[model samples]
Target: MSLLSFRVEQGDISRGCGFRSCCWTISRAVISSGILFRKKNQVKKGCSSVNDDLFVITDAPIHPEEVSAKVESRDAGAVTIFCGTVREWTKGRRTLYLEYQAYESMAVKKLAEIGGQVQDKWPAAKVAITHRVGRLEISDLAVVIAVSSPHRKAAYEANEYVIEQIKKVVPIWKKEHWEDGEQWIGDQLQQVEYPDGKPMKGSGTDD
Candidate 1:
């Protein structure tokens, strides 16, 4: 996996010249044979993380039930599952579909990183997160997060925390296929705080 270099200036994030390297790893996993393959299922290719906590980035379709099963246990009286999907409309544009990519190694590591934060924040919560890469049609499942805890509130809060963290720190990128054309977007949720300039938020055919 290649390291990403970005600088913060004037309270905005700007990408480094090696910016191309950011998605270079993603190309190998998602752009096989010049095609972007996004299955309706979660794609499982390698070991997920430091724990058997089920944090993964895949091309296969995500099944919430399966993810939930992995984290659910008798010690947990409450189980919360959050599924993120591709919406037909984002901002004002109508997207036909979306293709996602990621720095696989770093992505899973960051996922586990989020898992660590969740456990620390909610001692009783158990968390599992799965993300899919490749082409996804509108309304297709993009992410599944499972959090189980003895208290319902802990499970709920941990679930939200993991999702926000993934969108902020993960290496996953997406291309919005609009009715007119397609463009590669930055991070999972760019609308959020971009402390620095958001250079990767532009759209173009030239990757």
Candidate 2:
């Protein structure tokens, strides 16, 4: 198993690093995948304001209601949510579980970028995205996406768009474990692979 290492920025104390002694607490979960291990507070990035708009990457459990509340608004007639979960089966294989990892900094950046794109395409829409990275058991929520818009049509469309863009752009990778074995399966689009045994740093497809 491999773990992606991060160089904590000298001043990003919000990321748990700085002149202070506080730092991100690492998860004790064993590194069981060739992809990466899930660590507590390993990587976290998101909005720094009071608005509903947000983007986050973390190793914590994601709650749909919490995420949906972030994007809730009286003006928004419709609020759409998309929850991605770990399934027990894929193809013909009975999956045991899944391990997810990401290039945290870049993944959050891309997620924010996708949010920008959503707002650009649907100017009246507000979006919030929370993607969990780490070990996920069958039926566990891996991601919670919420999009609110003035109209239901716009909300649905924007919500779908966010996920599609995430698959194409976000640097999050999933390793599937089945009864047989496990492997570092690449992006959702199947357009990228970690042939060298790990994601390529600073690359869009590195996830």
Candidate 3:
């Protein structure tokens, strides 16, 4: 498993412990199923070279260390890594598996866009993001974002910014393969279930 995969299992299980007591570990074991934003006052003209290290979509598992290494400069004192992994349950729903499909080029561009946004706020920070496409099993690493900076605060903030923007703008579709049924739905948490699990009108298809 990659470092990102490891961090995800560790962090999410810790969070799951709050939701479940004795079964917390089991609940986390099932994480085949499942942050913040900032304001942009102005538009940027072009993408940033800072993201050239990555901002990608791949079928292979993500390596968090590789992403983190992109920002590992002598100038960087802190590196904050955020790993988004596939979990077992979402809103009491039992997800057997998940299929992640994406408009690959579009998704990659959006990730680069997020990197540009991060540079706007935290100029000293460097970011690398990798989101796996195709099918992902429970506890699989879905996305891994690594941000490094001279200080820890900037790394943390930039890492969060990139993750949130990917959710909002990246043209990546995830279908929840649940025990009851599968649904190509919105929201990673399964909070928004459209009628018949189709995209909302004017929302476009998952095609």
Candidate 4:
């Protein structure tokens, strides 16, 4: 039986205490549905609780340790943290700095969705992702991702998977401030280009 698979009887729900009340202790339950019902931002254990996942699109400088702490769990034997920083150059062009922007609401939603996918694939893993927007100087931390799991392999794989998935799905863009001029990188992969010098239009205002 998977740790996430559990059936909360009607009586259990009526008690106002469901899966989260004993997240770590109910691993031996039956496997029917692989969903773990948890409070909106938290998972409770006994009398205490911690954020189940952290997903944010912020304008402030991101602290890696702070993001990592969100996923810490006594059941996790390994936690993998990944920090992405602005580089000084891209290809042969020298970059002075970089500016990042995102459709904040949707980007955050996509981040949480990615976290949910991670949990589905690695049931024992918990993930947190924080991406910074606004201007970033050389070597500035742009994104931080942390994943904790009962083993190192799942933690490492899940952390790498999150970053790649974010790039492919999240609506976050970056502009390179070159020595000569600036260009909006429509897609982080650089496959899509914006001739008008803006992010690709979509839902929500890019703030």
- TM-scores for candidates 1 onward, in order: 0.68, 0.71, 0.70, 0.72
Query: Model 4 Cα displacement at 45 (Å)?
Result: 25
Worst 10 residues of 2 by lDDT: 12-21
Q: How far off is residue 180 in model 3, in Å?
A: 0.9
Candidate 3 has its poorest 10 consecutive residues by lDDT at: 17-26
- Order of all candidates by lDDT, from best down to worst? 4, 2, 1, 3
TM-score of 3: 0.70
Which whole-number lDDT from 0 to 100 does residue 79 have in model 4? 66
Rank ordering of all candidates by TM-score, starting from the highest = 4, 2, 3, 1
Query: Residue by residue across 112-196, what tens digits does model 4's lDDT show?
Result: 8899999899999999888888888887778778788888778777877887787778888777778998877655543455668
| Predicted structure 2: lDDT | 0.64
The global Cα lDDT (0 to 1) of model 4 is 0.64
What ranges in model 3 sit over 4 Å off? 1-51, 187-207
* Tens-digit lDDT track of model 3 for 1-207: 222342221232113210121100111111221201122112121222223656767777766655555555666766676777777887688878778777666677778878888989999988878777678888887777877777766776677677667666777667778899887755432234555765543243232
lDDT of each: 0.61, 0.64, 0.60, 0.64
Residue pairs with backbone overlap in model 3: 30-88, 31-86, 31-87, 31-88, 32-87, 32-88, 33-87
Q: Looking at candidate 2, what is the lDDT of residue 46?
A: 34
Better of 1 and 3 by lDDT: 1
> 141, model 3: CA deviation in Å?
0.3
